[model samples]
Target: MSVLAAVVRELGSEPVVEEFADPAPEDAADVVAAALNPVDVAVLNGQIPFRRLAPPFVAGLEGVARLRDGRHRYFFAPEPPFGSFAESVPLAGAEMTAAVPAGLDPVVAAALGVSGLAAHLSLTATGGLVAGEDVLILGADGQVGRVAVQLARAFGAGRVIGVVRDGDSRRVPLALGADAAVSSTDVDGLAERLRAEAPDGVDLILDLVWGPVVGPSLAVARQNARVVQVGNSGGPDATLNAPSFRNRGVRFLPHSNFLFSPEDRAAGFEELAARAARGEVEVEVERVPLAGAPEAHRRLVAGAAKRKLVLTTTSGTD
Candidate 1:
């Protein structure tokens, strides 16, 4: 009953390919694809606060897997000893699992799961983003930010602007649905550019890279604008301008995937999966073998990947 898995055999050690007892059907489901994310990388480094599993535990938080009826399903927070990085993993629950929409690739579903849900909920549920309002996405070149840029448009935003690392990184967001993109490195020019792009001020700000951008973004925010902090990829801390935020009457809403209820998660996935199936949203994915997970983790930590990295059961050689 042994199956291949990417196991963290020691603290601070790279995940290695190993054999572990296969999860029984009643307790686990077969995984088809496991998508790597910032949190997964954090878990590996013992950075996730709630993650306390020691060495010998499987690695990965969520993935797309096949259900008993042979349909693809997405699940999150698998049992401690087994995770999504293996051929099979313990199921979180029926509430945490959703059928992949027809025509959506399992790899894409796995890649989009938590990130997509974050974007959808940030704009609609949390930000109260409505039609005819301007939406700004910081770190829009990254996975969830890119998805948020597209979702902002699909959700009927009058304008969608993205803040990327530089001019070179601007095209992807623009092509994905953003009306314009500003460079994050252009610190002095950020406020000007934001004003130029969103003359009336941005109604909602999806702060994916919160640190450096928060201050400048707040300067261009419309009165009563809602800034939803979704990720801290740039850095966990930010020096904010209190007066600007207070004068604008802006609201800062911090978001975590854990804040979403089971019903909300399922609904988010259904909406995003349908969008993917209709080709309205697409994720550029790089396939890697489960054995290459260590290398994948290294590259991801270094921020070297230009596309979504997905690990599958296939041999690493392609």
Candidate 2:
């Protein structure tokens, strides 16, 4: 059967949806819903280190799919060029796939594939965050940041502060679980503002924005504070002074799904699904049809999407 997929034919080019041959059960699996994530855009733009991918390659990293036997699962990091941003995609190995619990929203499950996993692992595994510790999430208005805020609260953070671009986006993080929200646009006084919100000094920081926010946040971090660099949407470079961090013994952890074992990935998905089932984890998503994937790609690349964007196939995932 023919399938529709978003193809990236050139480096740094916007993906265009086109027809492609469908993969059989032995070859791959069928995607029911796919999410437009920053990794997909980064890979298409040649930011990732995949040297094997050539032109006209499928571009996506995660999706919700159904096995030939009709079992629903969340698929992660399908070997690139045969990614998840399609009406159908190659099945990932059993190690990278997880059964989706009944009653969880398929689109939300697709959106949470990598982002939610990263958040959960960052706090519990890397940060070693303890209940009652003050937690701050930079770029808290973004998809991963939103999940991190909620997860931080669920993990028992005493105070959760979300840093957004402005006051308009503050409500998103607050509603999710943040005790307070601050705007990154508070240029000259950003550090002061954060210090005020976190008078005890932040114990752990989930930093999605690495540019200006990170450096200032580092200055106010408490002794032994752990910082997880999850995303670099603001900019890749972050300034750090050796003497400053040395005094506090602050640690920087770069969290990625690649660091996880297949078993680890599956368990993370299961826990996230369970949280969603209990109404603890919820994703605010913008549903776009599979045919509109090209436009969705365009908007996501331009940072136009205010909410997580999930591509829905004809099977009613929307």
Best by TM-score: 1
lDDT for residue 119 in candidate 1, whole number 0-100: 88
The local distance difference test score of each candidate is 0.84, 0.82
Q: Name the best candidate (by lDDT).
A: 1
Off by over 4 Å in 1: 92-95, 314-318
Q: How many clashes would you count in candidate 2?
A: 2
Looking at model 1, residue 268 earns an lDDT score of 76
Prediction 2 TM-score vs. true: 0.92
Model 2 lDDT, residue 199, Cα: 80
Superposed by TM-score, candidate 2 places the C-alpha of residue 239 at a distance from the truth, in angstroms, of 2.2
lDDT of 1 by residue, 1-318 (tens): 889999998867778988987887677677889999878877887888877677788898889887677678888878787778898877754337777986888888988888888888888888888898988899999888888888887778888889998899999899897889899897877888888887888888999898777788887798899999888877989999788888879999988767888777877788888988888778889988888998998998888999989998752122
Shift of residue 210 alpha carbon in model 2, Å? 1.9
